[model samples]
Target: MGAGPVYGQEVVLTAEVDLAEIVRSKYDFDVAGHYSRPGIFQLTVDESPRSVVARKA
Candidate 1:
């Protein structure tokens, strides 16, 4: 079989907040399913300003 897909570089960050917990607590949302499957969530610096203001308000 041919190669399944081409892969690009990857970057990982260790942030202070637990992203999954924040999403569940703030929005009542869950990225991982009932079995706790792994998933990806993307947050960019562009959202930082708006997020900060939202938290303050």
Candidate 2:
């Protein structure tokens, strides 16, 4: 997980997951054994500003 403040916008939180790890954990499968393409995920959060901000000192 990663976070950063966006000046005038809401804070951003980023989470990344590896598809190969998911398959290996869920079904005991190895992506390396089969032909698979690499994958990456990026998600964004845009909601209440108050909830995302931290009080300034």
Model 1 misplacement above 4 A: 1-15, 27-57
- lDDT assessment of candidate 2: 0.60
Clashes of each: 0, 0
Candidate 1 per-residue lDDT, tens place, 1-57, comes to 233344585555344655687657855554454434434455546545454354544
Q: What's the distance in Å from true for residue 27, model 1?
A: 5.6
Top candidate when judged by lDDT against the true structure: 2
Clashes in model 2: which pairs? none
The best candidate by TM-score is 2
lDDT of 1 at 32: 57
Cα lDDT tens digits for candidate 2, 1-57: 445655876765687877798667866645554435335433458775575567888
On a 0 to 100 scale, what is the lDDT of residue 1 in model 1? 27
CA lDDT, candidate 2, residue 50? 70
Point out the worst 10-residue segment of candidate 1 by lDDT. 33-42
Model 1 TM-score is 0.17
